[model samples]
Target: MKYSRLSIWNIVVKCCMSWVILLQACNNSNEAIEFVSESYGEAEIISIDPKKDIDEEYSMKASLIVSSIDYFPLTLPGDMVIGEVAKMIHHNGYVYIFDRHTESIFIFTGKGEFINAIQRKGGGPEEYRDIKDFEVDRSSGNVLIYSPRSQKILHFAITGEFLGAINNKVQHTSFFPISDYKIAIYNSRLSNGHVFERTFPIQPRFIIANEAEEIEKQDLETAYREQLLMYPNSSFGFYQVGDSLRLMESINSVVYGVDLEEGRVYQRFAFDFTSANPPRLYDMEADELSTFVEDYKNKKVGGWASLHRVNETADLLHATYFYDKQVCRIFYSKNNKSQVNIGASWMNDMDNIPMPLVETTTNEGELLGYYGSDMLSMIVKHGKSKPSQRILDLEKSQRDAESIILVKFRLKDF
Candidate 1:
């Protein structure tokens, strides 16, 4: 693939990209590969930095991106109480929400009909003691949950029947099924990682493993932190962006594209936060790793940024990040090279009223957000700017209901 390339940069990008590493298998392989990270830094890829823009007010408005809004009021029965929405996934005409507190997955139809809940939280052979993370297998319609406590991946039917479990030797807090053979995992060993985090000084942050649980390959190390706390992030995980599976680091805005076929990982996008990243944890010396955690706890900064979600519509790329101590959402226009920034309440010009946060996104390329009952009531009753009759009718129909209303919207092409 490199030979047919025109420029040297293209050749470098094709075979062993700058940050794209080809690591040897962890246990039984000693085939060394050059870990080159400098040759192709952020200069080659597109940088979506909001600091470059002069406008303090967000350029992106609800009207510019939102073509239409949908309200799916979920009907909850007496047995079901969604304690917390830890993770949500929409697939095959159904919506699955994992409640971490309850250790259960609640299923619902696309149109807001209550279905079933997968509540198998036991120490049996089929049940998982705890769920680290879960992904709905697209090809087979099976629910794959990784339980680090049990060191296994349990498979369950979409309708909540236990199929079986796969023995996993690899240490991962969360995993994304690349194919039947390939799986991309977020390494469990971080500075403040959860239960299964090892005390070893060095640990891989990401790994590619097989169904048998043996490591095929791994990349990036977690040697900077003083692994003492318990903070496991299943957010900013292996999410579908377009046709590719993207992995975004929690501390910074560097996103990687995972190749399912070659078991390769490469940098695809980065947000320029020069003031936030330089001279920090990654650059600390071996001796500094000892006291760095305590120092990091006390040290505060104004320029720090961490990406929360990166999703897109056909024409606009949406990204939400914590920048300079404020939560920001920016929509970058693909056609005009413009950016719209909104801090809260997307300017729902269609309704001539404010809408709640449009944060979560579905795999079908639609934005999924929500509004609690109290807030929605305030918007309808208190806002001086009245909503359009269509939006008013939608809210009025569910006015009496006391539940969180899910807002599913598609961005306009313009």
Candidate 2:
């Protein structure tokens, strides 16, 4: 006895539906993100421009307000004179300063009230010499102070207690703590013209893997092959999280993020460095390159290159490029992490700011020892020009007098 045609058709449909379910399971398995040992291409600045609607007026307005605030004059406790301020860090509701001349660390309230000195020049614990930079551990309340001359990043308690030190032979240009156990270190040198990174084992000893060395370790051939794997034509920056590195870049001036684990670069950002114009290139002689690099590494020339984390998702990112005499630009991320814009500070009033560049070996004719901001600020030595004139006679040639200008900026939606 055979079944009706309609019944046979219904059975066939049920079998087809069962097969579809099995196929869906297989597709999901294949779609899982696979691990690969992909390399990345050499990064270069593609394009950048000042953000629209920003101008000298806005930056001036902001500076005038911040300057007038009733902040205390930073003072050096004890025998220290609090010489020149190398950097001023705002953390834990306080402002920390590093004085180069006195070789001491000064602490102040957020509003600029002089609190106390953290360390002094000595060859023992609780002492420091040639302190280059310092970073605060927001979570553990520990502080990491780097003395480039000493080539060490010393850990200390926020209250001036000494902790262990990490001897990462690599000269740390900068660093950001991702947690109590891990940190991302940015390294660069005048001898080498590239910026690279390394992650340390979060322990106080901070043992670094040899493979996490400089970018030179990566050959050109590897870069070409992995170039496609990189977020299509984007500017990238790195952040640390435990043993992982967060890759950030801009598309059309918009910032994007990627999470990296075990050498894999995760693409998390959506924006790209946006510039319709091609990049501007300049080639200098070997001697000139050496001089420029040395000045930058030794902190002789006044300029700053730093990274900032924008939002909680830790998705947004920005880079601050500070030029001497107060003119600088902020590269900000756009929506969808696809584009970034180079925006100027309209509030700091940096128009007509003087940018002074000098060679240290030939310093007899110059008065300004260095140029930069008050915090992480460079030294301005006595000059040949009279104090009344406020002139910087860089050379006997009698260059015209110009005033130094500084600007401040914050993020805003257009």
| Clash totals, every prediction | 5, 46
Residues 35-141 of candidate 2 have per-residue lDDT tens digits of: 22222233333233322333444344433322321112333333444435444445445555555545556666544456776664566655556676667675664
Each model's TM-score? 0.76, 0.44
Model 2 misplaced regions, further than 4 Å = 1-47, 50-81, 125-129, 148-151, 177-182, 189-326, 331-414
Measured by TM-score, the strongest candidate is 1
What is the Å distance of residue 50 in model 1 from its true position? 5.4
TM-score attained by model 1? 0.76
Candidate 1 ranges beyond 4 A from true positions: 1-60, 169-173, 179-182, 188-200, 221-224, 227-234, 274-280, 289-292, 300-302, 313-316, 334-337, 359-364, 381-384, 388-400
lDDT of 1 at 172: 54
